[model samples]
Target: MIPSSLRARFTIIAACAITVALVLAGFMLTLIFDGNIRARAVAEVGDDLRTLAANARIGPDGRLVIDGDLSDPRFRTPYGGYYWQAGRDQQIDLKSRSLLDFTIDWRPQPPTGNDVAIYERPAPEGRRMFVLERRVVVSRGGTPTIARIVVGLDQGELDEARTAFIQFAASSLAALGFALVAALWFATSASLAPLRALRAALMEVHLGRKTSVEGRFPDEVKPLVDDLNALLQARNADLVTARARAGDLAHGLKTPLAVLTSTARQLREAGQAEAAADIEGEVQRMSRHVTRELVRARAGVRAFRRSHPTPIAPVAATLTRALSALPSPRPIAFETRIPAEAAAPMDETDLTEVMGNVVDNARKWARGKVLITATEAAGAIHIAVEDDGPGLPGDALSYEIERGRRLDEQVEGSGFGLAIVKDLVEAYGGDLTLTRSPLGGLKVDIVLP
Candidate 1:
């Protein structure tokens, strides 16, 4: 299949154009050189015919005769492919010794505007000849004799010259065409270099290595790079604005909620304890929703905007210490197993939020022990928080994790913890899995790249 690529198309076009132009040029040069060689051969033979005709004499024997000194020795050598002949009245003739008893098929033409005719004909021994012929009048003392003088030369030398020229010209032109096409390839690659660099920059942005494309670019592509950078800038600005709005809205509702909390406490002291407690419970639920909304906004922005490595050991240690100090009816042991340098590819804020929620949930349900372990595998970091408690029914494990579906409504909190952790984990391009723990309870595992 032909590749749908810019480089391939350009190379094919250049090769075709160079090949066609060189082929035509080579043929034209060969023709011109061949014509000149043949014309010179014909002209030299014409001179020989003229000299032979001028020296011819009608002797007392009444036979055509010629005695002349031709410069070329081939004229006197038999079958030398150079010859001269003279004939009259369709009878006997005089000819060069090179004829070797073979008569030229001679024909006479009436006097015309042109005195000489030049053409080609086949010769003895399968050789081709270039012929130049003229009609001449030889007058010795009185009567005139009309004679045809023809001179011929073998075309072998001209053919050899033409073949040699064609070979040299073809080879030279082929080499020249190759060099030019190679130069065109280098020029094309140099011109397209900027495009390759631009692609690398874009990939870096996508991988969260950089936020924008950088470096100088050619005029043709500069506008596209500028527009892409501008778009990233605008997106970041919009995220900042949105996050500020969420923070403001969450804080704005807190004051009214505080007033309601105060009023509910007063109602409890005024002999309406049951109704007051219900009001406090609803208030707490609303507060959890508001807090989770803030977390959601922060997770969304961090996931889309940027990424960095977050160390797992320190964050896990901090959460373990905080949860360990929390008051409980029974002593709860918090154990951490993490590699000191292990890190996950995620924002620090996101990693903290997710791990905090998972570890906090384990503390609530754990009977006496909560274990947090972190490890690296398959180019990702995995953090598992396991707890020992009365485990959920097999079918209820997934159901209880749904937002607001607490295993026990009698428990004193809204049920958005696991759901929020799920959201934050997904935002960081990671996953959260819940399964039966080896500790005889639930295991919340987080995998992040």
Candidate 2:
């Protein structure tokens, strides 16, 4: 597909319009010049014919004769592309030597008082001739005899002149079109510089390098930049307020839950053992819910808005040590195959929260061994957590990773670990998938950009 960028579209449209305009202008110019040259040729031939008619006389033998010299020398050269002829009573009388036996072949028509008639006629060697013809009356002894006089000039020179004009015009117009396209390209790039700057600012905002759009812009784009900055400011302020409220709510509930625990202890001491157990279970469930909400609050809008490069290897190593220290009935081996240079593109706190939950869950389910490995490729980080326990069935893989979905409720878990990891990964333009592991257990693969 052709990229739908503004520059490409504008260049195509402007180039088409300019090419069409130049072609039409060149065609019209050539046409007008050809017409004017043809008109001038007819007028010159008419003038020469008038001069020839004025020099004619009726000789005593009733034949036509010329009085004196016609100024043009081509009248004497045979086939010189110029000629003259005269006739009386449909019989040829006098003619120019240049005709060389090639007849003008013009039919004379009587003209109004001083008007001349001109037409194109055939001449020698297949050349075209512009002929001017007229009928004249000569008187002898007060009696008049009508005679026809004609003059012609070859049209080859005019055709050559028109061809040369067309060639020159075509070259000039092509040069002009090229220059116009070049100027348009330069002007278009310069005009869109502000937009390019705006795009760069947006990229920086996405990468958490800048808080808002910044820099000078044209009047046309300044308002847009202002609106985007306003949106970012509002978003950041709202996230801060929401997180503060969540923190306050969690602290408030913690105090009440602690008092409840103290009361349950007193009941157990007073011999109401069953009631104390039930109360403690309810309180623990409530506490877990509160902790889940706190995690959600931490993974707030700012989780994605404020990004910082966090090294994955160090965080994974720290998590490995913490998980290994936990007491388990079976000795569990923890393996960390992460490079020191591996980094994820997200805030450090968010990455810690997300990876912690995932690694802890793997430790809980793995029977003999758990593996945490991370690698960097293409502009993204890939982290996988695998375990050697009974993996989930293929039929349950799609929905089992969702929140509050535990295959066995007998297991002590709220089932929010994978869900939280998925949510946090997507928030930072990443994805998480669950699949069967080579270690005969579940594999959690995450890609963070």
Candidate 3:
């Protein structure tokens, strides 16, 4: 039986795989969003650098200065949160009051060398600064003088915002994973429900309580169920035919045996001992022949029964008991090395008859032992019978097995055993081979579909 927890394992694996993919996708989206936010911040700082450079002036001695307050209300507000510095000839000319009398300590770096550079430095108020710098050439006193503009943005707020976004994304991803696991559990159960129903239906058939399976199965499994049901129907029809044959054979032979018994009794009462003895002897032989024919006929019927799925163990056991009742039974050793529940599409009674006849024949010539064994291979069932008896003559064996031939003409019994085996085996879509046994006797190997 397969484990029930297998569904849970599958669900966990699927959910984990989906969650991992989604989390990676979500992280990539977060990185793209962070990049967009940083791009907008850089653009805003570039605009501020342009406006600050436009307000610069030059003294008569070529000292660069700012002519106005150069302090927008935006600079004083923490919401603006920006720092600016202007330098001419490498000397600070103007700075943001937000720097609070603290000069921006940015190195006068040429912006053309690198598009952007970020660094942490000490601010005017000794606060930590993340500063961005750019160099601008301004026309002062009609001469081009180089002025460097530095812009600083607060790092604490940006760091806090990024951390909050990461926390939110992590929590959302965790929730999505939990939900995915739950959904997977429900989906798996729903998908497998039909298989469970099919299992229960099969179990019912196994118990002999149902003759056919019926259900609305998924498209993938419908064909399997249909084939199984068709096989069951065919088996039931075969069983009906078998029962009819058995009944017909009994009805046909009972009257003749009764007449023979009555005739023998009448001869004895008339004081004709010699005639009575001869009649009785013939009657006994006739009776034996009738019985053997009935057995053979019944075996044919059984072969049809076994064309359905029939377990081998019980059939083998039944044969052993039935064959034990034979008058001249030898030490017939019946060995079955098959699973107790191993089954095939074979009639139990047919299997029994096949084994019984072969074993009985071995017992006739076996010195001490008759062996019967059954096994399965390559989707077929194989039964082999052997004995430690005088083996059949090679030429005689071949001649006897020929169709419609009888070998034991004077053997005071019906010589139809092998013939019947051959017919019945063929009817069941199987083959029977007669060969010399390793035990020094005839070996019969039967292969059945």
Predicted model with the maximum TM-score: 2
What does candidate 1 score in Cα RMSD to the true structure? 6.4
Candidate 2 weakest ten by summed lDDT: 402-411
Deviation in Å, model 1, residue 370 alpha carbon: 13
Candidate 3's TM-score reads 0.48
lDDT of 1 by residue, 218-333 (tens): 99999999999999899988988999999999989999999999989999999999989999999988987887788888987887765657788889888788877878888889
Q: Which tens-of-lDDT digit does each residue in 269-304 have in candidate 2?
A: 999999999999999879767776777666766554
Pairwise TM-score winner, candidates 1 and 2 = 2
- Alpha-carbon error at 400 in model 3, in Å? 48
- The weakest ten consecutive residues by lDDT in model 3 span 406-415
Put down candidate 3 lDDT per residue, 140-218, tens digits, no spaces: 5577877777887766546667788888888888888888888888899998888889989976665444667877899
In candidate 3, the residue pairs with backbone N, CA or C atoms under 3 Å apart (3 or more residues apart, or in different chains) clash, namely 102-124, 305-347, 306-346, 306-347, 308-345
Candidate 1's TM-score reads: 0.64
Q: Estimate each model's TM-score.
A: 0.64, 0.80, 0.48
Structure candidate 2, residue pairs in collision: none
Candidate lDDT scores, in order, read 0.81, 0.82, 0.70
Q: How many backbone clashes does candidate 3 have?
A: 5
Error in Å for residue 371 of model 1: 13
